[model samples]
Target: MIAFENAAYSYGGGELLSEISLRLAPGSFHFLTGPSGSGKSTFLKLCYGELMPTAGRLTLFDREVRALSRDDIALTRRRIGVVHQDCQFLDHLPLAANVALPLTVAGRAAPAADLSDLLGWVGLGQLADALPPSLSGGERQRAALARAIIMGPDVILADEPTGNLDWDLSLRLLTLLVELNRMGKTILIATHDLNLIRQAKSQLAARVLRISKRRIQLAGADL
Candidate 1:
């Protein structure tokens, strides 16, 4: 869970986010919507402690983010999975290795069978040995999701996950996310795709939040 109280983040010339107050409770699913350069990504970064608040307080799992040491932040990240827009990976690494990178970095050994099962669940079972550069856009996104959840984190933070995929692929990714939410994982996705949000609403309850005028607000029913 995460909470922000009058939180503001500033860089270069001015503030990207200001006086924002929000909370993500356990097992809640929320969608973040905003125009380009409107702080959706910045907000996601704050959620996982990638950036500290410049004004007020932001707390993750009941602890003030800025107060955490580097090692503490690293450990805290283990409880939060993040999917980025780019789906970054080592080009030369096989899909299996890429998916297992989190466990590797955490100094935990991944059993081969479990790894295969996870890949299969994400629809990448047959492509485990393929290199990241060889994957299609949707495949890369799914692979990224697989890697993000490999640690079995309590919270999942995804930024523009469906930005590059077609409608079908987006739905597939959304279904996977919905399944995770049903299993009680806290989910927050920052995306510009309103159709995807609407599709998610058809399957599960999801609160939509929009960033406008440098503040976060609940979206109207018009969405």
Candidate 2:
């Protein structure tokens, strides 16, 4: 659903990502793996229109990022679900309400049944009334997953989703993502955990992409 054509992004005078051209095909699962400053997060931001390419072209669902207006970009972002590296929540609000924030931002009311089902899908049904600060690392990540998908996004872009969780919990979260992919959602997750990547590879078909020389490379052998 996201495409890049000879796209390059730069900061000051240095290019962060260059000569990038790849299309995230519909219903595909990809894991972006690279060093800390390898522009993994920058790539995710470009996919959802958070940042525009400095040169060449980048498109989301066939619409050029440079051509889309601010409002248009905001609307386009609704089609993508993002699980941030840091799963921050409003400590004052309950988990359910935090998950419902997207709906509220979209000026729509959260449907009770759907919300509950989503929470349960991410294994957070019992924590609906729990505060954010009270959740464990795994619980917060799942809650973030629940929140990310509550709006029914067509594409899921997760950045370092399992960074803080243990192996068992990481697999638990990965299972939910794999299930989502089976249901026809395009999934792209940026992570550095090779162990988690290997585990995900066992569960489903996933392409491992590495950033090298400021470009995206398919590392089939490495994974």
The lDDT per prediction is 0.94, 0.92
Off by over 4 Å in 2: none
Instruction: Tell how far residue 113 is off in model 1, in angstroms.
Output: 1.5
Q: Write the per-residue lDDT of candidate 1 for residues 1-223, one digit (tens) a residue.
A: 7999999999897999999999999999999998999999999999988899899999999999988999999999999999987989999889999999999999999999999999999999999999999999999999999999999999999999999999999999999999999999999999999999999998888999999999999887856
Q: lDDT of model 2 at residue 120?
A: 86
Worst ten in a row by lDDT for model 1 = 214-223
Q: Which stretches of candidate 1 lie over 4 Å from their true place?
A: none
- lDDT value, residue 199 of candidate 1: 92
Model 2 C-alpha lDDT versus the unseen true structure: 0.92
Using all chains and alpha carbons, the TM-scores for the candidates as numbered come to 0.98, 0.96
Candidate 2 lDDT, 1-223, residue by residue in tens: 7999999999889999999999999999999989999999999999999888999899898888999999999899788999986889999999999999889889999989999989888888899999999999899999999888888899999999999999999889999999999999999999999988888889888999999989999996956
lDDT of 1: 0.94
